[model samples]
Target: MKARSKSKSKSSILFILCVIAIFSLAFTGFKGFKIAGWEIKSIGEAITKGLDLQGGVSVLMEIQEDDVPSDVRQRTKQLLELRVNKIGVSETVVTEEGEKRIRVDIPGAYNSSEIVDGLSKTGNLEFKDSEGNIVLTGKDVKEATAVLDSTSSPVVSLELNEEGQTKFAEATANNIGKTISISMDDEVVSQPVVQNAITDGKAVINGMSSMEEATKLSGIISSGALPVTVKAVSVKNVGAQLGAEALPNAVKAGVIGISLVFIFMILYYRLPGLFASIALTLYITLVLIVFVEMKAALTLPGIAAFLLTIGMAVDANVLIFERIREELSIGIPIKSAIKKGFENAMSSIVDSNSTTFIAALILYFMGSGAVKGFAVTLMIGIILSLFTALIVTKILINLAVDMGLLKSLGQFRVKRGAENA
Candidate 1:
């Protein structure tokens, strides 16, 4: 029965070993593969890279008029961030530069004109009566589409929401046979006479000179408008060559750093150290998978946070191992020592990592751009570190002890006096 128990333990350990090997290769190995007609991309290729890592477009914009209110500027910044992100550029950084300037960095985007057009145009669609009083704004529009009229001419059709429908019904009813001006950013695009109240919440602007004009108007109307007028002051295209060089260097440094940690763990704690290293490997794989699946943008600061967390992870394991050593010194049996070690270390690990987790949350919420990137990575690392130390390392160490692979306290480098105890 004892032999059978040892055999079972050994098989479990072997299974763990296979998991480590397979996960390492599958996630960090060469590119990725296809399964059931779906291509699974490697973490390197699949993860979203930030502007500093992938390089793209940077545009500096400023309010066209002086003395813009803070709330207006803030609303403009928020709107720009949403607008660019909607265009499918992930991890775009839109930050306030100075009192008057705003900087936007979009990774993997190259079209300067499109970027400028999407951002600089206030797109504030307004309707006014012949006397020039504002009647409706872009906020009233539910949908905008570029379509052809019965005459087969390009036009923009607008659909108003419920509130807009009632408002428009009143406006048209009062202004029959009077011209209503449709303007974008105070530039009049069309003036159509309202012949009747005929408001089914739908209206069309007829004066689009071309299909492109109609399409552009429709898109801007649907995307919402900037609260303030802004113009691009400077536009620069970022090249990926620096990012191309930087990524490999960062990866190499991480590899070297982690490799050194593995060596130290193995040399110091012996069997437990070996098991800790495996747990560390699993920690990294799981973290990267989280990042990829979350579509989190990884930047230079994020990578630094990642490396910092690795040290934290090792620190956790070290604490647990020392506790185990202390337990063994008191003459506890191997399995009981391993279990007590973790139980004793649990409070310290949680206490230490929990503070860091709170700090990460604060930074993530209050900070922006790269600061946010760092906070996100740090937060992920702290959670994973705790998990690996409390659960993964404990399981592996207990398994080794049960399999009789760890036979003496000396394997954990406990003092020679305890080796015989």
Candidate 2:
């Protein structure tokens, strides 16, 4: 029993720890579970999808402002979708209506009129001169967009007309240390310093709260370049006062499904069952984290897709563990069995998931609304499952056994007729 060199054990443990960290940071402790002070997670956070599951209200909005162009309404609709999200419930759906109208669906919410009012008004984009003079206005500016610089600080950039550019350069050079006020729909957006003379028809507006804000301003500025006046012509004044009751049921179903899956895996697999259960738990945590981090909508169909992904993840584990048991029963040592089992079964795991992932891809492009939601979750689940089953679960079990965590060959339960035994 010569002691394993510290480096040998250290590297093995590190790889296992890497697998754990990916999921732990991903899941965020299932709301913060800890293992010896480190939070337990599995992958990057799983983003939640919207209903198609939770059920939300859909409202149609019409644009009537004479100032707005028909084509620009679509652009305005996209921008409004971003802005209305600030109220922050969960998932909000905004889509274009026939030319002069738009539709919005706020999940688990029937009341969003106030939000509608705020987004209905066209954004006001302006540029002030060295001495607060109205210089290049949004009308003269062609476009504005957020771009990351080498430093990665979010910058909102503007391009102006030749006439506007000349005026801008002159304003900037003369107004050094002065502020250029920017406003949208009469609301002040930014008052950044005139850092230098801009003779290149381009300007960077500094000073903003967040990248999110910068993105919004860029949209607003462009909204002004191509003005679109949208007024709510029709309001579906409905309240999901009824949906509040359904939210709890969605949660219950998710909990029950996961619990049953865990029990089944453990009952069939023995010690390896416990290992697979742990990995499956990690799988779920990551999926939810991705949802919250990405602001994905948690719809009912999306939840079903999530559960299906979980089962697939378990199947991958079962396949690999079964392969390992087969190897060990043939008189191979524990170390060789683990490695060979994983290596040989890798092909099968890949073949099965690849086809499923491609199907999800097709569904995502062809489907609309709820179908899209289901497609997205299925795609995400397949990717995460592959990582967990092929990499994370195998790494965990191998590390446990390598670190002398398993006491004997019996721990894996390899036997004759093991297929039915």
Best by TM-score: 1
True-structure lDDT of candidate 1: 0.84
Query: How far in Å is the alpha carbon of 231 misplaced in model 1?
Result: 7.6
Please give the RMSD of candidate 1 to the true structure.
5.1
**Error at 78, model 2, angstroms:** 2.6
The TM-score of predicted model 1 comes to 0.74
Tell me how many clashing residue pairs each candidate has. 0, 32
Report lDDT (Cα) of residue 171, candidate 1. 94
lDDT of candidate 1 over 284-328, digit per residue (tens): 877888998897888889999999999999999999989888898
Relative to the unseen true structure, what is the C-alpha lDDT of residue 147 in candidate 1, on a scale of 0 to 100?
Answer: 91
lDDT scores of the candidates, listed in order: 0.84, 0.70
The true-versus-predicted C-alpha distance at residue 60 of model 1, in Å, is: 7.6
